[model samples]
Target: MAMAVLERFAVLSSPDLDEFRHSVSQFLTPHRLTPLAGNTAGVHTDLSKTSVGPVSLVYCRNSGVELGVHLTENVDYYDINLALHGRNRVTFGRDEVVVDASRAAVISPRMRVDMRLSDDYRQLHVRIERQALTDHLEAMLGRSAPAVIRFEPDMDLTGPAARGWLRTVRILLQDLDQPAGLAEHLLAAAPWANLLMTGLLLAQPNNYSPQLERIDAGLRQPTPVRRAMDVIECDPSADLSVDRLARAVRMTPRSLQRHFRSALGVSPHEYVQQVRLARVHEELRLAEPGTVTVTEVALRWGFTHVPRFAGLYRKRYGTPPSQTLRDAL
Candidate 1:
């Protein structure tokens, strides 16, 4: 529901270089832009942007000229740039990288960046809030990060995983084009935002890579099981699949399952079901009898099959779900 707070889409275009630069800065970050020495009377710039929760998808093209942009003070977000046409020479911190279709770049927050774009350059950029990403990292690490998380300037986008991430971005952009897009709904947008963030975290090499690798190896000081349990208890309605839970606590699925069984005498899946069942019971007891049904409550808590859900409800609550609803009424 928090995803519903922002406007969904916008488009901006201009033939005036200064106007275009100003518009782009308003949409993204503040930067000084200088047109390269092509004494042209007319240059065209087009920008399209879609905001889905904390993440923004932007596509921009500047034709018939080269340009240089300087961001002396780092912006408070991460920029993942994918050059779709032509190329860009990006200098961030001490490193410089050429970004094109095959090579992507992740620009960290608060880092000075100098970039030069070719005449026909077009790019698909994803901007994610630093706080949002840092929160996600903390959730994955099961603790606060010791320092600022920085990424390598260049990333190989031709790999299978990276390609998959690109496909997701393309789909998101396409969805945003519709008048009644799926992203307009909070439920759809929230998951899409999470997917993009999680995908970026996994795809890009960052400060947390070693810790993640350690998690995969089952060598961690903080207990992942406890963290996983805490997450489940805090938000049972979250999309807490085995993979997501495992990633949160920095463990392989097998490792997480083993730890859950060893500590709680139940698998993670079973624990989640139990928690959902309890939540369903609480909601049913509090519901106005005819206003809500058992099936609705069951589905809300992730139980899909009505007959099977009734059976489980009976087993857990010593009564049919309908009876619980009826009694509450």
Candidate 2:
């Protein structure tokens, strides 16, 4: 079983940073930090208006080789780190990269990331909730974030405009002592941050290869297909005719059929029937005999035509639905 934990914190002092780090360590799997080679490390953090948004900022220090540090926690949020003063090295999923005062990094919570700070490094850290980042970025970029993104080892972060934006946001954060209730802070920051990040991403050469670009294009079109499948899966008892599905996806019936054939090499009506039969088979295999009738199971998944449904079910499953239901008892 997967364990999930969500923690919300507002820190305004040095002590708060200590407490927050402790909480984060405990929440993740047991992870320890040690000094890096030939360097000593120290950290200082101050928070201004923490309640303004889901933004949590911290300051970090390092002066040597830091080792054995692993972010083992599976977080469901967004962590964006801006290196203000020190160089940071990270190993995420076997891909190693180093970030410094010139560049920023964003890591999703579910992945593990290990950090090694340079002895002279100091930085500002920000963690935003995952959904907030995605929704905001998608709206601003007119696309979705890829499943994974790791900056290449030699990627540059020297763009003056990008650096200026980051500085301005940090200054704004430093000036606020509490959340202003005048407007939604997240809504206000979403565009600014997305635009800034978008520019940064585009500036990185080799960020999107031909294969990756093709995959990205495919993901955009798959939404309609996924939605049609969801409707069928959600209520298998309903009529899932191609005409209905086509209307649901805002396409003509012929177009829908063509799409399914091109994408999955199957007709839409056949797909629905296959799904319904599979659902009925599962229920028969797991359900108690007296609790449900084979005919009832068939009808529940849109098999109103009893004889035809049974004939097809037996041919596909190599047994009558009634026999499977009886065996479950």
Best-fitting candidate, measured by TM-score? 1
Worst 10 residues of 1 by lDDT: 1-10
List TM-scores for all candidates, in order. Answer: 0.64, 0.44
| Candidate 2 local Cα displacement, residue 88, angstroms | 1.3
Any runs in candidate 2 off by more than 4 Å, and if so which?
A: 1-20, 23-31, 36-52, 62-68, 137-155, 159-171, 174-329
Cα lDDT tens digits, model 1, 112-230, are 78999998788877999888887777566544443577888788888887788888887777677666888879888778988998888777888887765544443332477768978
Q: Tens-digit lDDT track for model 2 on 109-172? A: 5667777766545555555555564444433323333334433434445677455556555554
Model 1 lDDT, residue 102, Cα: 86
Error of 1 at 85 (Å): 1.2
How far off is residue 102 in model 2, in Å?
2.5
lDDT of each: 0.78, 0.57
- Distance from true location, Cα of 101 in model 2, Å: 2.4
